[model samples]
Target chain A: MSEKIDRRMLLKATAAVLGAMPLAGCDLASQDPTVRGILDSAEELTEAAQRTLLSRQSLAREFPETAISKHFRANGSDNPDDGDYQRLARSGFADWRLDVGGLVDHPLRLSLTDLRAMPSRTQITRHDCVEGWSCIGKWTGVPLGGVLQQAGLKANARYIVFYCADTFGDSLDLPNKYYESIDLVDAFHPQTILAYDMNGKPLEVPYGAPLRVRVERQLGYKMAKYVMRIEAVESFGHIGGGRGSFWADRGYEWYAGI
Target chain B: MVRATHWIGVVCVTILLLSGLQIFNAHPALYLGMDSDFAHPAASIGVAQRGERKIGVTTVFGRSFDTTGLLGVSGRNDAAERAFPAWATLPGYQDLATGRRWHFFFAWLLVLDGLAYLVFSLASGHVWRDLIPPARQLRRIGASVLDHLRLRFPRGEEARSYNVLQRLSYLAVIFVIAPLLVLTGLTMSPALDAVFPFVAPLLGGRQTARTIHFICAFLLLGFALVHVAMVLLSGVWNNMRSMITGWYRIKPEGSLHVGEN
Candidate 1:
């Protein structure tokens, strides 16, 4: 029977399979939670494979004397809607003392001015946002590693979590926390500055002013803006749904190492 | 109708790739916020002292980094810089201009084709019946997906039509990646922006959208790679014919390695 199959039948079979590739492609990319969850899981494997294939990447190059884009737009929330933030904004972020606590012996609450007083590092590296944009800018700030050292992280700490002032509410059950997490690896990178300044100017409120993360290895979103408090933890489990950040908690891959 | 729908989808994908690569290759200025939405992480870095000078920045930030030539072999730099994007092809003289022309000229076709495809798909039962797997399959599909990654299991359900994985991936390209690509293109274009008042803010900004567009292409490209691989595995001749002629018959009698449901 197999050998006797008609040519038309064979052609129909071929047509069916060939014709369905795009449909197959569409099927793999649906949004039903089950389909989404299934796709999301498989998608991670591909991402991991690609990551392995392209591991040990040298940081992207920085050109000499390139003009920093005239404007570096904010990627996330501009002004946080939280009550404390609204009141703080009314006073112009003056009374605001960034609390650096949790898993540290000597927790620190330094004023924005006090942070500026510390020795600062300046670099002309370009900022890459996860959204398809790049801008070369001179970021000036105290190295974040320096600030962590001042706060004195305890021996057990492994991950650091940043709690933000903004919330993008979608899941009613889930807390609306705009947060991000990074391990000790990125926490210590040289260009991983806690950017207080951009383009030789103080970071405006929109671009994560007063303090935002610059995990230069990953995309710009890893650089959280409007930083309110930073906590050092042994594990990420209790940190806002455990995936790390707001997006991470949703369906986003945790590493975001890209 | 499905035949016409299929052609439109193919055309749309082709048009999208042409225009997308053009916009990418054009080196349009990508700003900071248009292309992405991640914005959390405030863990700080600290200091380490080797000598009186204290050479390296220490551990407050909770992210990895390295120093440049100033420190040389002693330090490392993170790979996030945009000196050259992963998607930018090194086009030759002959195809470069044509690629860009085809990209810009056919940009509308991709947009229109995609819109039409979406509308048609919604009207057809195919989207609900095949693409979006039923509630029961969702749990297993999710679990099977995890199992596939660990290599403990590399299978998912094998339906005559689209499976769970195929359906979801298509959804992502259509909704997440495609719209993002379109928005980013619009952001890079001044003429378009002039026509659309809220496009920039609707997408955060032109720069953000630009970055979003590029990353989304990579996702699409990834999907295409797996699509080809699946065709070869499932039987290339059969798959190709199905796409070209819009008819597919189940192979008479070969053992199918159905993916775990």
Candidate 2:
């Protein structure tokens, strides 16, 4: 009887340890540089596998107008609390300009009217969030490639970074402003656009009014909203937190195709 | 190859499951269509307030169930509002980024290990010889199930091969469920959807695929529990020895075996 009790105790102890192992190990492993590196390598493998399998011009699935979600949830920074953004918003963003520079032959500062005047593309596409939800919306905007072509992208330019007006944190500092970067492959993709219209209306403040990016092939977080500037750079090594985007700096995958 | 891959798969699946739960907690809801209809989730775990009290509510289809302390509301003082409790998740915290890292890394390893197993199993005729039951055995599936229920496992020469039920379950897990899990997982990737346009639609859409993925994960877990229980019931030491050393002692017919009780 004593032996049986001891065996039962042993079994319970083993089960308890086994149950707790993952919780403890995962936290410790994530902090270990080697383990973290090994884990982070999967992102690169996924990106490479996707790039190899997909053609450059392959388009994300576009939905019909009827398929568009009636209420699209605005995520992350829905409205810019920055003073400059508020000033621009008060004047209907007439004074807002998208400063395009960095590794470009021509530096252009284009106004909202200027962007609207450019050749535009309208696409009804699904926006997939990294949090596992998806929403379909109609976006009307100018293809990013057209603007890059107009700016005359330098031969060395490899990445296009977007600086947004919205600050993600409590601080109203410029350093906290939301930003995202994508490689030339995504930048020149036909569906990649700086959208100014959502669902047949001018983009609302809750949905990055005036301007937001629609990188259809990637997750919603990759699509920066409340666009303030566009930069063509060879590398984002010196950019905010050096991870290519606001979320990426906070440990989200830069290549959010998955 | 089978033993090595099996052990590796065990590790991968455990990490994947815990980390997957962590990721699931980020949303804590499931939908049926292509997109999430926020107002009408097919299933959701959320915390609802009743006056000064907080309650964990789980909605399935449209029916609400109070799954407090287990599902939506858990942790000390009921502070955590998550679908699955922290104990059930890797890192034991709300870090979606780290959870994703662990999930994808192990997911890749699992896929590679499965592929290796598949190639070796086919090359060695393991699939046909062990997993696929003969027509005669298939005909006696009901009898095999009865034998299993009675805890009467095969002995002597009969013990050299899997029974019909074992063969069928193994085949289903390997061919049907695992592959479905992989395909459904890939369907969630927007980039992959662009490459394989028909995958999402074929599966009834991305959100439906997500639901199916979650269901298939639980099914795999169920299979594991049954598999482990069977291993223990049949002969724990003998099974462990065979899996570890590839030497299973087959008792002679009608011979009394040690630890038979």
Candidate 3:
């Protein structure tokens, strides 16, 4: 019996080892530079296909009017402790200005009043959170594309970066700072806007009053609250993590298409 | 001891099947702190709060939770959630949390049991002998791959404990499916990324992980179905008794014999 068991064990060990070796080999194959390059190219092509394959106007799920929680938790910094932001808040954010520059034919530094006076688009959309909470609200804001067109995006500008007043840096990640960006396509999405009023009232300080982002296609982290500056760049190579956001640097996927 | 071990494995698998379904369903198991203004069907409290204030389909959570203008997608409010029936849609938070806890608990049980079995089998030499296929198996394996996959067990003592197909399937389930489930679940937890920042990037993204998890679950479900069918078709009472009492009572041609594990 022992001899028979020994024979069986030997055969089993050989088979098991042989069975697993190929998978490890496959892993090695994947790590090969040429293979890696091919895969990366496939991923890029897939992203491009995904862009034009589906209409950006697809509607997401909307919950009942009653599902709105009484208090939506303010996720990040409620107020900027920065002196400039504090002064603007003290003056009711009337003097806050949104500077649009970088790779733009026309750089514009417009006051909050000027932004508010521009033609606006209102949308009732759901906010999918990284923490998994979601809420729907009526947002009234100027279209982001109009602002970009007004500033006149430079021919080489491929993406727009939003720099906020309140720095939610180091809170979500070890040392990564909080910032967000969007490509030219999302910058022109119909639902995309520079919001000023939330629900039905003038935006409050905690809500990025005077101006904030309203990119309606991705998860919550891409929304850079607090209006201050917008920069358009061709590449994110020098940024926190090439993905163009602080959370992206901390392993959050930049294209949170959820 | 082998018969006893088989019986124990059977019992554990059965318990796992039942509890796993309950946890996945999450309905009718009213634990505290599980009230949704809108719960999933598998959840009584997930879709709607215990005392829901409204039944309308257009529930709007306030502006704060709205990803729009508040940490939204690509700076656009990512309003994208998978479509669900008006009555069935739920808050992604509540559903994910409770579903996760239940899923995690069962997952731990599966992992622990699987690990313990591995250790036991290794110590007992069962892994080397009983679980592995032979070299001659490759020779018999070549011509009719499809027939083997249909699981046409040859017959009698020549039947062997398991065939090449079974060996491949079991190995894949243990190595591939189990790890996929674990990694995908980890990818979804935002906090998990803080300590193990490699998860989402490794899996591509949170949504990508979710898609992979679903695929893995389907694979496991397929394995379970084939396993149950094979057991039932072979000899229900014999298989059941072998797992329950450890020694299979083989009665052939009016003679009774007990097979050694």
Candidate 4:
């Protein structure tokens, strides 16, 4: 009996050490630049594979009204703490203007009322988060392509960058303003819209009240909320952290198709 | 081809499992519908304060269990409050982004390696001649199972080829469980859903697909454990040699088998 117990203990100890070795090895490997670069390449491979498999005009699945989630979960910044954002929210966004500039042939600043007058499309779609949760919500918005067309994107413009009002970071002292960017292929996709309403109601502050981009084909983080500016750029190398998006800067995949 | 793909698969599966656990730590919950109905999660792991002490609680289909030290919460002095112990996850820390990076890289490698193995197996007639049991073997499945329960593995000439139980299990792992894992994994990707709109719904829903993926991962882990035990019990050096060098030492006929009748 004692010998059996000894053997069991030895087995347990061996198993524990064997299990712990991988974790230690992986942590050390991840710190190596070459290892990280190899891992990062998978993101590009996934993007290329997905783009090849999907048509440029392929639309995400649209669901019926019954499919809408009962309580849509709001993530990231619920409300921008910036004073300008607060004041605009106080006045029901009457003074809020979406600046469209950068590589655009026609720089334009439009108010909420002007955007409301534009042709709108409403669709119910699933919002898949990077954290493995999903929510279905009905979004009503103007096609982002139409807005970009109105702004007259310059010949050099290759990417659309969305600058948001909300600031996000672990520390409030050095807040990183939320931002995201997408290539022209995704930017001009028919289903890509700047949503002003959700679930048949005027969008609430919790859900990016004034406006949020709805990139239906990508993960939730790609759909930047509290969109304050839409800039057409040749490249996003000069953007915050030089990664094109806030989350991407923090190691999340920029494409986010998966 | 088998030996090369087997080792590659071993490495890929190890990384995939550990990194997958890290990703699961981000939400630490599972659901079974079109979306995550947060109010009614099918299973979830969380930390709760009980007086001055914090306890790790794991809930499954509304039933709760205290799974501290091993799950829900674990670390040196129970400092970490994440689902799955730090030791079980890649990086040994909470970094979903890095975890995802490792997972995707290995996932692609695994798929590529699996494809190579499939092609080789088909071309070499390995699947038909080895993995598929004949009708006679199928009829004696009950007796084969009884033999396994008794730890009475085939010996001498009988051991030259895979036994019925081994063939059936290998077939199930390769043709059924492995394909399900891949299909369910692809179903969870929102981008794939856009192109193949019917995939997720056909499997019930994205959340259901996620659940199935998790279940399949555990099933694969279970198979690996049993496989290793069988390898050790039947003849560790011989089995390892066969897998490593495609040469297995078979005991001569009528030799007394150790630890068996």
Model 3: lDDT of residue A110: 88
> What TM-score would every model get versus the actual structure?
0.48, 0.94, 0.50, 0.94
Model 1 lDDT tens row, B214-243: 667778778888877776676677677676
Task: Give the poorly placed runs of model 2, Cα more than 4 Å off.
Answer: A1-21, A170-175, B257-261
Give candidate 1's TM-score.
0.48
**Compared to the true structure, candidate 3 yields what TM-score?**
0.50
- Residue B47 CA error for candidate 4 (Å)? 1.2
lDDT of each: 0.60, 0.90, 0.58, 0.90
Native contacts retained, all candidates in order = 0.03, 0.77, 0.00, 0.77
Worst 10 residues of 3 chain B by lDDT: B27-36
**In order, what is each prediction's RMSD in angstroms?**
22.6, 5.2, 16.1, 6.0
Q: What is candidate 3's CA lDDT for residue A227?
A: 64
Model 2 gets an lDDT of 0.90
- The candidate maximizing TM-score is 4
Best by DockQ: 2
Pick out the ten consecutive residues of candidate 1 chain A with the lowest summed lDDT. Answer: A23-32
Cα lDDT of model 2 by residue, B1-261, tens digit: 898798779878989989899999999899998998999999999999989878899999999999889999998988788889988997688999999999999999999999999999999999988998999999999898899999988877787788898898899999999999999999999999999988999999999999999999999999999999999999999997787557799776556565454
Rate residue B253 of model 4 by lDDT. 58
What would you estimate as the lDDT of candidate 4?
A: 0.90
Off by over 4 Å in 3: A1-49, A56-69, A171-176, B1-261
Docking class of 2: medium
Question: How good is the docking of model 3, by CAPRI class?
Answer: incorrect
lDDT of 4 by residue, A123-158 (tens): 999999999999999999999999999989989999
Candidate order by decreasing DockQ: 2, 4, 1, 3
